[model samples]
Target: MEVFALVGPLYRRVQRKIELDTARQGLSVGLRAVLDLLREHGPMTVPQMGRAQSISRQFVQRMVNDGAANGLVEAVPNPAHARSSLIRLTDAGRAAIEAAVAREHALLREAAGDLTTADVDTCVRVLGRMLRLFEDVDVNGQAVS
Candidate 1:
């Protein structure tokens, strides 16, 4: 229970840091997440992104729309889905996200100065198990599984 309590505060602190860091580059938290997803997985549908993030499809759609307007992302025709297009990152998006991530990585490295790889690994394992314990629930507190 204490670990769960710590997780929420730590997450909020990191989220705040991310908002500050990304805002300088004219990106919101959602936009950064969209770019990161495209960078890691290449082109994907909006529905797929929503599923991966466990967020609303409408929310992801709004983020994609914003990214498209800013020329960070463009939608290409999907061969499998006639209705849904696959979203991919533009060169500008790639550059922006990469730079942001690199900056964040530097901050994380500084924060990790005292923590060992094994310590981090064990922490990750614990956190992952905790996440799985609630994986069946939707973001809205509805049962998903």
Candidate 2:
């Protein structure tokens, strides 16, 4: 329960930071998330992106549309799914993400003022374990034993 409580606040704080940083770069948090997803996992369809980000397909599509309009992302034909298009980052998109990331890194460094590498590593390890535990649990709230 304590861990679950922390998740929401932590997520919101991280999102707020991202929002602030992305705003300076003229990108919304949603679009930045989509770009980061593509950069990390390669090109993916709207559905694939939605699943990966745990967001609605419609929302992901909207972001993709916005990105396309901004010349940040382009639609490529999906070989396996004829009707679905894969979204890939353009050179401009990659540059934007790179800039966003650099800004984020600076922000994180400032935020981490006193925290050491080991402290961050320990936090990551603990959070990763909690994530795995959550993943194994079912929707009905039963643990998968």
Candidate 3:
């Protein structure tokens, strides 16, 4: 219960900061997430992205549509799925992502003024364990592992 209490507030605070920081770069937090996903995982269909991000396919499609309008991303032919095109970041998109990442890194550095690398590593390990525990529990209240 204490963990749940901390997690919600922590997530909101972090998300708010990211939204503000990314907005300054002319991108919303969601779009920035999509950009990061594409950069990390390569071209993917809207449904694939939706699954990865735990969002709806329509929502991901909307983001991709907006990105296409801004020339930040382009739809390429998907060999496996004829109707669903794979989205890839454009040169402009990569530049925008880079700028946003730099801004985020600066913010993170300022926020982590006193925390050492070991502290961060410990936090990462703890969080990873918590995430795995959550993943092992099914939505219907069944323990999968």
Ranking by TM-score: 1, 3, 2
TM-score of each: 0.95, 0.85, 0.87
Candidate 1 residue-wise lDDT, 38-111, digit = tens: 99999999999999998889999999999999999999999999999999999999999999999999998988
Best by lDDT: 1
Residue 94 lDDT in model 3?
91
lDDT of 2 by residue, 13-36 (tens): 989978987888889999999999
The C-alpha local distance difference test score for the whole of candidate 3 amounts to: 0.87
Ranking by lDDT: 1, 2, 3
Look at candidate 2 and give me any clashing residue pairs. Answer: none
Candidate 1's C-alpha lDDT? 0.95
Candidate 3 lDDT by residue in tens digits, 53-108: 77788888888888888888999999999999999999999999988888778877
Select the stronger candidate by lDDT from 1 and 2. Answer: 1
Error of 3 at 114 (Å): 3.1
Q: State the C-alpha lDDT per candidate.
A: 0.95, 0.90, 0.87
Poorest 10 consecutive residues by lDDT, candidate 1: 108-117
What's the C-alpha lDDT at position 23 in model 1? Answer: 94
Scored by TM-score, the top model is: 1
Model 1: per-residue Cα lDDT at residue 98: 98
Candidate 1, pairs of clashing residues: none
